[model samples]
Target: MTATTVDMEVRGPWSLATGRAFWEGFAPAALPAARGDDLTTVLLVEADWSRAEASVAQDGGTAAITVDGDGDLDAAAAQVARFLALDVDATFWPAVGERDPVIAEVQAGLPGLRPCGFHSPYEAAAWAVLSQRIRIPQAATLRSQLTDRHGDRGAFPAPAVLRGLELDLPGRKAEYLRAVADAALDGLLDGLALRSVPPEEAIRLVQQVKGIGPFAAELVVVRGANAPDAVPHHERRLDDEITARYGDGATVDSVSAAWRPFRTWAAVHLRAAREGRLHEFG
Candidate 1:
C-alpha cells in the first residue's frame, strides 16, 4: 500500500483563542510541530501510512497539517479542512454580553472568543476520566503514561485494546488505571457507542466506571461528545481559577453565570489561562 501526505493552510479573519482551542482539543501535539512559533490561521496536514499529524500556529495565522496512511489523501485532507473550517465559524465563538462586568471585560479585551467541540467521544471520555481531581500537568503525565503503557505504540489505542490491559503504576495511580481498565473490559465504558445515546444516558454509562463520577462524566459529555450545553460541576481547577481571578466571591454560579449559553467557552478560556495564554484572551 502506498501512503500520501499533504499540507494546507486554513485562512480567514482569525482569532488566537479560537485557533488554540480547536487545535488543542483536536490536534494537540501537531499544533506545536507544524507552526513552530508562528501564529497559525491555517491548518497543515501530513498524512501517510494510515496516520496523520495536524499543525496550527495561531500567532502566525495558519495551521500546518500532515496525514499519512494506507488511505486516500484527499479524504484525509477533507477531514482536516472540516476541522479548520469549524474554527472560523460562530460555532466556536464564545457569546458574551455587556451585562456581566467581568465577561464584558473579557469580551472588550479579546473579542474573538469562540465555542469549539471535540470530535472523538471515546478520547474525550478517556481524557476526562484520567484528569479528574488532578493538576493539569500531572494529569497530562498520567495520560501519557497510560497511552504509552496500554495504548498502541504509534497511534492511540483502540477501546478494545484498553479493555483488558494490565496497567502497572505506583500506588494510587495503578489503582485508578486498573479501575478504568476494568470498566473498559466490562463494556461499561463505551464512549463511542454512547455518543449516539442521549446526554443523560451517556453520562450514566461513563459514570459506571470505577473512578468516574458525575463531574468526570459530565466533562466527557461536554468536552468529549461536544454536547455544547453540558456544564461541568466539581471541576476543582476551574473553581480555583475563578477564586484566584475573582476572589472568594467566585462561586460556581457567580463565576459561570455570565457565560450562560457559552459556559464551555469560559471553560476553555480558563484552560488557556492555565497554559499561560492569558494574553490570547485579550
Candidate 2:
C-alpha cells in the first residue's frame, strides 16, 4: 500500500482533547515516527476515527499523522477532519447544575471534551460490552488481551480479522467475546450504519449482544460512536467525584447542568483528573 499524506486541521474544542488522549488509550502500537523536532507520527486505526497518535513535531502548530498500509488514507483523513468539526450543542451535555460544588469544580477544570468519531459501531459496541462491570484499567487490559488474541497484528485489527478469529476469553469475559464475535461473523454488525444511525437505534442494536446493557451500549455510542447525547451511567468514580463535590444526592443531571452545551467537556475534565493532568482546581 502506498502511503498518502493527508494534511488537514481539526476544529472544535473536543478535537484537541481527542488528539491528546484517545489514541493513547485505544491504539498503543501505532506509534508515529518522529520527524525533526516538531513533527511526530500520528497513527490512525483502520476504519476508525475515535483514536489517533500524537507524534510531536518541531514546528509546534501542526501535527502530522501517517496512515500507512491502510486503504484510502486521503478519504480516511477527510472523514476524520469532518468528525472533528462536528458541532455539539447544550442538549447533548446532560444537565449538571444544582448538583454540587465538586461536580462544578471538575467541570470547570477541563473545558474541552467531545465525542470520538468512530466509523465502526460494532467494534465500539464490542468494546463497550467487554468493558461492562469492570474498572477502566481492567477493561483496558481486557481489550488489549482481546486484541492480542483476536485482533490483527498491525495498528488495529481489521474487521475481516475480527470476523475470522475464534476468541478465547477466560472466565466471564469469554462469554462476552463470544457474543460479540458471533455478531461480527454473522454480518449483523453494521459498520456503516453505526456511523450514521440514530443514537437510540444504535444503542438498541449494540445492546443486543450478550453482556452489553444500557450503560455499556451508551458508552460505545457516546465515546466510540460519537453520539453527543451519550452519558456514562455506571461509572462509580465519576459518581464519587460528583458526591465528594456535591454530596450523596448528586445526580448526573444536576452535576452536568453547568456544562449545558459542553457536557463532554465535563467528562474530559474528569478523565484528566484521573490522569493527574491538572494538579489542583483552577
Candidate 3:
C-alpha cells in the first residue's frame, strides 16, 4: 500500500509541540507517546486506520501530514486538520485577551497555543464517560488497561475491539463505551460531520447516546469539536480562577462574558492556574 502525504494550509498560531503538550500533559497514556516536533497518532479514515503524522513548517502556516497506509488520504488530511484545530483564527485572540488582564497574560505566554481535539468525536465522547467520577490518573489508568487488553500496538482500541469487551468498569460507563463504539462504527459520530455543527446541537446530538449527560455532552463538544464557547459548568476552583481572572470578587458568568467565543480556552487557562502550572506556559 502506498503512503499518502498532504501539505495542509492552516490559519492562526499553531505549534506542534504546544498541541502535543496540551494532549499528553494530563494523560500521557491516552493513545501513544505524542512527542517531539511531529505529533503522531492513529487515525481512522473511511474504513481503515493509520498512523498519522503532522508537523509544522518553518513558516508556521502549514502542516505536512503523512499517513502510512492505503487509507483514504483525503480523509486522513481532514482528520489531521480537525485534530490540530487548524481552522481557528487566533488573529483576534490578542484583542480578546485585552479585555481581561489574566487572559491577556495567558495568551501572551502561550503564544502558539491551539486546542487539540481527540482523534474523533466518538473517541472523545467515550473518553468523557470513562473519565467521569474518577481522578485524571485513575481514568488514564483505566484507559491504559482497556487499550492494553484490546488495543493494537501503541493505538487505542478500535471500535470493533471494544464492542466485545465487557470490562469491569461501572455499568453505565462500560455500556456508554460500547454504545459510542457502535456509533463510531456506524458513522453517526464521525468527526467531520459533528465538528461542523453548532456546539449546542452537537451537545444535544451526543446526549442522545446512552449515559451521556449535559456535562459529558458539553465536554465532548469542547474536546471533540473545539467549541470555543463551551464552558465546563459546575467546575470547582472558580474563586481562585475568578481572582486569577478578575481579582477577588468577579463571578464566572460576569467575567466570562467578556471571553465569548474563546471561553473554552479560558477554561483551560483556569484549570492550568488551579493546578499551579500556569508557569509552564508563562
Candidate 4:
C-alpha cells in the first residue's frame, strides 16, 4: 500500500533533537525507539482496529508524518501528534521559564524539550500491569517477548489481540493485563477521550481497572495522555528535584504554582536533568 504522508504545524518551540533524545533514553522498553533521524513506530488506529506504521520527523515548523498501513490515516496522524506532544499549543511555554529561574536553567539546557508519552493509554496501562513489583529491565523483557510473539512488526498487540492470550507470567500479571485490555476494548482507555477530561478525572477513570494504583493511574493520565499542565502528585523524583532547587521547605504544590500551564514540561525537564538524559544538565 502507498504510504500516507502529512505535515502538521507545531504550535510552540520544538526541536526534533530533544524529542529524539527523550525517545532514545526515557523508558526505552516502554516507548518507541528513536532510529536515525526519524522516530518510527506502529500505531493502532482505534477507529477501525487496524495497524499503521508511522515515521515522524521534524520539518521546520511542522512535523512530517509518513504512514504505511491499511487503517485510518487521519487517525494515525492524530495519534502521532499526541504521542509526540505536537498536539499541544505551547507558544507561551518559554514565559513560564522566565518567571522561574530554576525552570529557566533547565530550559536553557534542554531547549524545545516536549513531554513524549506512550503511544496510547492502552499501552501505558499494559505497561503498568507488566511492570508491577518488578524492575524495569525485567518488565521490558516480558514486554518484548509479548510483542515479538504477538505484535505486528514492533507494535504492541491490540487489545483484542491481547485479551484472549493466556500465558505464564509472574503473579496475576496476565490477569491484570487482560483486564487492561478489556478496558481498552471498552473505549475506557481511548487516548482522545482520556485527554479530553481533566487529568485528575482521567486518573480516577484508569484506576478503576484492576491492578492499577494511584501511581499507575498518574502514568496513564500524565504520560499516557500527555497532559501538558497535569501536576504529578506522586513523582518522588520531582519532589526531590523540587527540594534540591528550592530548599528543604519547597514542595511540589508550593513551587508548581509558578509553573502554571506548563507544569508537566517543567517537571520533565527537572527529571531529565537529574537522569543526565539531556546534553547539558547543569
User: Which digits, one per residue and each the tens of the lDDT, describe model 4 over residues 159-213?
Assistant: 8899999879999999999999899899988888988888889889999999999
Q: Number of the top candidate by TM-score? A: 4
Segments of candidate 2 deviating more than 4 angstroms? 14-66, 78-108, 111-120, 132-142, 182-192, 195-201, 274-282
Ranking of models by TM-score: 4, 3, 2, 1
Better of 1 and 3 by TM-score: 3
Q: How does residue 215 of candidate 2 score in lDDT?
A: 76
lDDT to native, each model: 0.51, 0.50, 0.67, 0.83
Tens digits of per-residue lDDT, candidate 1, 61-162, equal: 444444444455565555444433432334323344444555555544444644333334444555665555565566667666665665444444555556
| Per-residue error (Å), model 3, residue 188 | 3.9
TM-scores for all predictions = 0.61, 0.65, 0.84, 0.94
lDDT of 2 at 216: 71
Per-residue lDDT tens digits of candidate 3, residues 144-243?
Answer: 7876677765456878878788788865788889888887788767666666777678778888878778877876677776666666665666456776
In model 1, which regions exceed 4 Å deviation?
1-18, 21-51, 55-68, 71-95, 108-119, 128-139, 146-154, 171-201, 243-250, 254-258, 274-282
How does model 1 score by TM-score? 0.61
lDDT of 4 at 62: 87
Query: Could you list the CA RMSD of all candidates, in the order they appear?
Result: 6.4, 6.0, 3.2, 2.5
lDDT tens digits, residue span 25-128, model 2: 43312223332333233333434422343322112223344444445565455444433423343333334533434535654554433434343445566666
As a TM-score, model 2 comes out at 0.65
